[model samples]
Target chain A: MTALAERPYGGSRGGPQGGSQGGSQGGRRSRGALALMLPALVPVLVFSVGPLLYGILLAFTDARSGRNTETSFVGLENFAELLSDGDFWESFRIGLVWGLSVTVLQFLASLGLALLLNQDLRLRGVARVLAVVPWAMPPVVIGLMWRLVYHPDAGLLNGLFGTRVDWLHDFSLALPAVIVVGVWTGMPQTTVVLLAGLQNVPKELYEAVSVDGAGAWRRFWNVTLPQLRPVIVAITSLDFVWNINQFSLVYVLTQGGPGGRTRLPMLFAYEEAFRYGFFGYAATLGVAITIVVLAVLGLYLWRQAREAD
Target chain B: MTRALKHLALLGYVVFLAFPLLWLLSTALKTPQEMAALDPTWIPRRPTLANFADAFGEQDLLGAALRSLVVAVATALITVTLALPAAYALARHRSAAGRIAIGWVLVSQVFPVVLVIIPLFMVLRRLELVNTLAGLTVVHVTFVMPFALWMLRGYVRAVPRELEEAAAVDGAGRLRALAAVVAPLLAPGVVATLLFGFISSWNEFLFALVILKDPEVETLPLTLVRFVGPEGVARLGPLAAASLLATVPSLVFFAIIQRRLRSGLMAGAVKG
Candidate 1:
């Protein structure tokens, strides 16, 4: 979802904040500009906006098919029902744990890996492209591949650890297993972003710190961390949002199984919508996800707006 | 860390990243005899291509791939074609409406695909597009258009304004100037963006699963997932084999555009 391409946290490059005032400023062709934009905007309006609003509207209606299969409006009934659903709350809790673990872990791994790649090591370029291999993989392929690794019998984890645990099936092990896979696949862009941030960090600052007899940790904490802070915060926050929204990987690996232990909110929403045909309930779940995502990203967007001003 | 230690750490990371892919490759080559063994082996004792053959035999990988290719290419082309004008306007012209459009694109990026997928599925069903490649392509266009528009806007912003102005000064219309002067310079960006569009379409799962129900019309991802038995056990060998094949196009396109992607990624960092 442009998550990979746009994973570079923050540097004010005219993203959603509209920092590009460099375009055509003439009054005569404002109409021309509008005309030019019409084609692209039309599809977004037709496909994206229309459905999003419809989905929200569906949330407030009796849109289920099982017992009460009417499309009549029932204001906040789905949401109120959702508030009391233990399964929804359980999914949300799992989602929070899942999202936080992946985001925090991915950030640390990406930062460390980025630092390693930023070093003047030979084959760093090769490593750079190879690092992208995981990111380039289809999420489904990743899920399938990881499922084998987590296989109960003759799995690689078993071979490596001398244990017979069914990683994706064991209730205690399922979420962690899935989290590790999530971190693995989500590593590339964050690493790239941090690596870029590292490379762009002026060399003179490093030399200056080194000349002052600073150790590596001191230098990093004093120089690198501060320099990378905005990027770290930005990427980490976006990663959190992405992790919360992730569906395919977890769906593929466990299908939110092992007694719903790994049923993230997305999978829950999906099951509610497709599996049970609870459109209204599922739409409420969708709205909940959107609100969570917006809340997560709202901070960054607000900052971007302030910066744009 | 010392240079040796740093390289050691880096090597560790490379192993971490490469291990799963290596395992997938090795698993695809392992014979059923090797797979059935109680113990796992690092290298397959009797590496065979039979799993891939079996995978191909089971599902029409070639047909599904063809469908995927048609859909991905169409999505990329249509998205880029539509986004080009929008990107040009967004990049070269800063009006209030244009700004709002950019903002909308940003919002669309984070808008849950699930919310839209249901209704889009309904709309496509009504239009008899539920199982067609064309229908799948249109759905993907909506998914990718915002990203393409924003990314290409960044690229279009990088193209110097003077080139278009120079052509316009010589009696060329604005559109002609854009075509003659700006389009050539945008080649690398277009390639990279199109590659991303292709990858997103090819890798997409939920929309395809929801919309395309016919086996004959299923994409590679759908076919691959169908390998799961009703008992819910995935056929690991054949699944890995087919997965490797499905991933080849994206990996190839990735390599083709790696140089641009590195640059584009750095330049394209707008998704917060």
Candidate 2:
């Protein structure tokens, strides 16, 4: 991922020696660069970096939402509370289930669609357009539309199945129902990314495999899988992070509803902050969730990179 | 047999992807009686535009839409203004600081808004900017800045340095060279970035949810969510119609960007 940005461009206009040898010129150039950067950097520092640091500190405090509330340091106390918080553990478990299942399902579904789109097939343009149209959709609209689909009485899901199942409200089905929406909403990008990766694979490898008497499945396993691994790793890790951090889609779909069945980690943190107004605790929740997700992601990416090497 | 199965699989995907959308369009057009029927028809027996009319007539729908438009336009303008020069710097100057900036852009995407937002809310409250569209616009700018920078930098890189150097050799100053030599070349990228920023801000929900507490300031997505409250089937048609309407800007965005998107240049821009 970093490599994309680091792909060396053409001549550096101001070389390293240009500064020291042409001292005044270098100083002026440096000042100009800083000036160019400051417009974007200042807002990022104030609104993003500063708040992010303050939020980390807030995780160690007792900062509530009210104006008159006394704020005090409560180092690791919230963490202690979090450890014993049964509701939180339940929500975290639900979050893992939601994140893992959605990521996996989205990957598989998108891979299938991407592979199909990469084929020499008729109506390819129309299919490609249809596949990507969802990428353009607002998540809120996607959520609301799916809610219509899963509506107990008036929903298309019930109408098609000829069975009355309150998909989003059912204790057993709500998670799966929301997972389907998550997959649908996420498919276009995953498919597009994977399709791009697929298109990049050398056709000669497929020819070599075929000449060696490899069947289609064997060719895919040996040739396609190995070649696509980097893109797979990048996109899937991103998908996992995006899935766990997903709030708006699930929020609009079920509002963590029918007993918080659809509450991903981000949704859980949102509730802590907004619904209940426990600002510090919410920050703690957010921090804890990020550490865990990053650790998992780091391990996964490390193994993949090592394997690639 | 395999070809038939391939066609079948392709058809299945197309149906899976398109069905919900078609269903949404169907719901928007169905009459109340059709929506209330025991069995829902794929095509409405009695189609009507009344639902679309009702969607507009709904309380605050039009106002909320206007608010959404305002925020989106402001975000697009501000995001491009900030991202353009920053992108130019990152593209031209391969400094350690530039590398760090790129690293920060990637890292920023990983951090949860929940983490930043709590402290941000307090900061905004102190600034007396909470519950204001201006505050919401600022947040959207930061939210989109990373990806917009990434995209615009790519576009900047796509414009070869020779052109800028040629302009420079002709006695154009740095800013002059950029404006005269680079800006026109970067117009499509600028428009793409603007559309992306606009769509993201227009569709943003969670930040707006936190920032805009007053119903009077609620954006379109917030207002649309309100329509889905436990009011039952009475509100379904309008909700569907409104949902369909909310998708228009993004559809137009996609139509324009579809070719560039297929080039895979903007792959990293979307969250998922």
Candidate 1 at residue B185, lDDT? 87
Q: Estimate each model's TM-score.
A: 0.92, 0.94
Highest-DockQ candidate: 2
Give lDDT: candidate 2, residue B99.
Answer: 68
Q: Mark the 10 consecutive residues where model 1 chain A has the least summed lDDT.
A: A1-10
Q: Which stretches of candidate 2 lie over 4 Å from their true place?
A: A1-28, B230-234, B261-272
- DockQ by candidate, in order: 0.48, 0.52
Q: Rate the local accuracy (lDDT) of all candidates.
A: 0.80, 0.84
Residue A256 alpha-carbon offset, candidate 1, angstroms: 0.6
lDDT of 2 at A293: 89
Fnat values, one per model, are: 0.48, 0.52
